[model samples]
Target: MTTEKLFPVNGVELCAETFGDPGDPAVLLIHGGTASMLWWDAAFCAKLAGYGRYVIRYDQRDTGRSTTYPVGEPPYAMSDLATDAVGLLDALGVERAHVVAQSMSGGIGLIIGVDHAPRVASLTFVSTSPGGDDLPPPAGGLPHISTPDWGDPTAVEEYVVRSIEAESAGVFDEEAARALVRADMARAANYEAVMTNHYSMNFDEPKGGSFGELTMPVLVVHGDQDPYFPPAHAEALQDAVPDGRLVLIKGAGHGIPEPLWDEFLAALAEHTESS
Candidate 1:
């Protein structure tokens, strides 16, 4: 069973759900921009819990049931988001956690690893780049392009389906995506904030440390067919870290494809256990 609660962190309320025993090692699942904890499915969390990990997934500010700002007016910077993660750990009384982050959150993971190294046991970056001018840009342009009518839930669902279809190359369940999106729209405090605020947030670069300074075990997992950040980005990320490894999901895309869940979970279990 999973327990849901609201936490006061970084002067904002963040809705977080936890699976498995608190006595076990903790895994913090951080979603990408414009996403909530729903992106990290309950079943997936359960599987990680089954691996003897206490898994925590939360809604970032401006997403899900967490705090929100007016459309296009996010009061915090990207670095603030990273600090939020650390604040959440402090609130939870967890001194250290294995951080698994996807897409934009991967950058957040890097910041946390560099700035708050003592709070993290390991780092898992999925479907995101380490950000350098030399890295190859996302294939076929950037993602999250199709805008839908915010008032129309059906339009929003269809838009999500279309976005997934474009971003993925492996097995995708359209109905499942729709069901999740439906819940997301229904539960969101402000659906417009979910769609627009993240894109406009100021991104203050991390201070004092670089990726090469990360001493913890870092795992870079990327879909071979990921359009947003290609395989080369994963390679570059892996190469940047002193102790890093890469896992390429075959025929996968920017998101974690259901068909590759087993492989992803196994990699995660091993990485966290060894770390």
Candidate 2:
């Protein structure tokens, strides 16, 4: 993978990994809540590259190798995160690219696609819901195993290890699971700003105007058994966007990097190509 260094809107330095030729069509991938760019698995990235597209994945601010916020006030907002995405593209001299996002990052990508239309060739939302007063939070609260204090390294590491072991028992390959767990641990060590950003985005009421402004093709992918954002949430988002399609993956849950990787990549490729 090729690496590029970027400075975002808030002056946070970030690292982005690139696959495929630079001249190929580009797809920018935004990962879900508490996840770094490494959440996008190597297999999926390779598949996209094999499709002859330039795939770019970055650690959002406060995650992975990106710069983190100091101990003072948090600069966390959906708008700020969305702006960082655009700024990354600008820094890379990319005029336009298809945007693919999962979980909380879906909202960020939507904001960018609607507000900065020219910069987005298409929008793909995976395992996410559009934010609004009517939207429901995750049912039964989040899984105990999934919840971790963003500021606590020990808790985060323990959470990662437990989550991976629990979720990947007989499903995910052992090596892949271990790598993902390690990546999650690394991300959690620097997660204060990203978690703050997530909370800020969650509590803020959706204006409801930005989504309708999206003219590019939109694709929503959700697992049939997703515990976090249920399938209904994906349906709601599909109804909200003018041009949206929903694809449901059976026997899959909230996470997309493992069992649903192939389906996710296929849907992404189809959407990007059609758009």
State the number of backbone clashes in model 2: 0
Query: Least accurate stretch of 10 residues (summed lDDT) in model 2?
Result: 199-208
37-135 per-residue lDDT for model 2 (tens digits):
878876688789888788888888767777766533456677677878898888777889999988877778877887788889999888888766677
- Per-candidate TM-scores read 0.95, 0.84
lDDT of 1: 0.88
> Which residue pairs in candidate 1 collide?
none
Measured with C-alpha atoms, the lDDT of residue 84 in candidate 2 is 87
Task: State residue 206's C-alpha deviation in candidate 1, in Å.
Answer: 1.5
